[model samples]
Target: MAMAAEEIEALITGGIPDARVEITDLAGDGDHYAARVVAESFRGMPRIKQHQAVYAALGGRMGGVLHALQLTTAVPE
Candidate 1:
């Protein structure tokens, strides 16, 4: 099963209430996506950890219902 963009967004926001999330369907298919997430919580975190937070928000859906994701994360400027 493929994941919807809204579903992805909701999951992220659910995990990180203060996050600003933007999701794009890169392939016009629900299996592929790109997400840019900005949050105050990310400040002082390593880039790898930032990405991990987003993945954790998906609750292990990275390789199953959600196939490919090109993710970017940043703290609020």
Candidate 2:
């Protein structure tokens, strides 16, 4: 099953209430997406951990409902 962009955003926001999330359906298929997430929580975190935080928000949906995700994370500027 493919995931909806709203679902993805909700999941992220659910996990990180302070997050600013932007999700794009790269293929217009719902299965492939690109996300840019910015949060104060990521300020001191490493890149890998920042990415991990976003993945954790997905709750293991990647490679299953969500086939592909190009993710970017950043601290609020």
Candidate 3:
């Protein structure tokens, strides 16, 4: 089954605990999502690393319950 936005957001925020995340559906399908996360944990991280960190929060659900995730991360300014 495809995941819901709330389900995905909950998993990400719950896992990170210190993130300000905004989740969006790009294609109106549960399979596609874009997330912007701002967190102190991302400080000094590279763009790729930042995205990876967010993916890590999903615990290997990237290909299944969480189909496609386009992520943008930044440290709080």
Candidate 4:
């Protein structure tokens, strides 16, 4: 089943309490998505690690229920 944007946001925010997450449906198909997550907890982490954190937040949904996530993560300045 395809994932909804609200579900994606809920997963991310659930994992990262302090995260500010924005999820977009790239194809409007509920399968393709883009997420921009900014969190204070991400400070001092590398870009790859930041992305990893977000992926981790998804709890292994990347290729399953949630597919094709173009993720961008950043720390609060």
Per-model CA lDDT versus the true structure: 0.95, 0.93, 0.87, 0.92
Give the per-residue lDDT of model 1 (tens digit) for 1-77: 89999999999999989999999999998899999999999999999998999999999999999999999999998
Give the TM-score comparing model 1 with the true structure, all chains together.
Answer: 0.97
Per-residue CA lDDT of candidate 3, range 5-70, in tens? 888888889888999989999899889999999999888889898888788888889988888988
TM-score of 3: 0.89
Q: Tell me model 1's lDDT, rounded to 2 decimals.
A: 0.95
The best candidate by lDDT is 1
Give the per-residue lDDT of model 4 (tens digit) for 1-77: 99999999999999999999998899989999999999999998999988888889899999999879998898888
2 versus 4: better lDDT goes to: 2
Per-residue CA lDDT of candidate 2, range 1-77, in tens?
A: 88899999999999989999999999998888999999999988999999998899889998898899999999987
Compare candidates 2 and 3 on TM-score and give the better one: 2
Model 2: lowest-lDDT 10 consecutive positions: 57-66
Each prediction's RMSD to truth: 0.6, 0.6, 1.1, 0.8
Q: Candidate 3 regions off by >4 Å? A: none
Worst 10 residues of 4 by lDDT: 67-76
Please state the error at residue 48 of candidate 2 in Å: 0.3
TM-score of each: 0.97, 0.97, 0.89, 0.95
- Give model 2's clash tally: 0
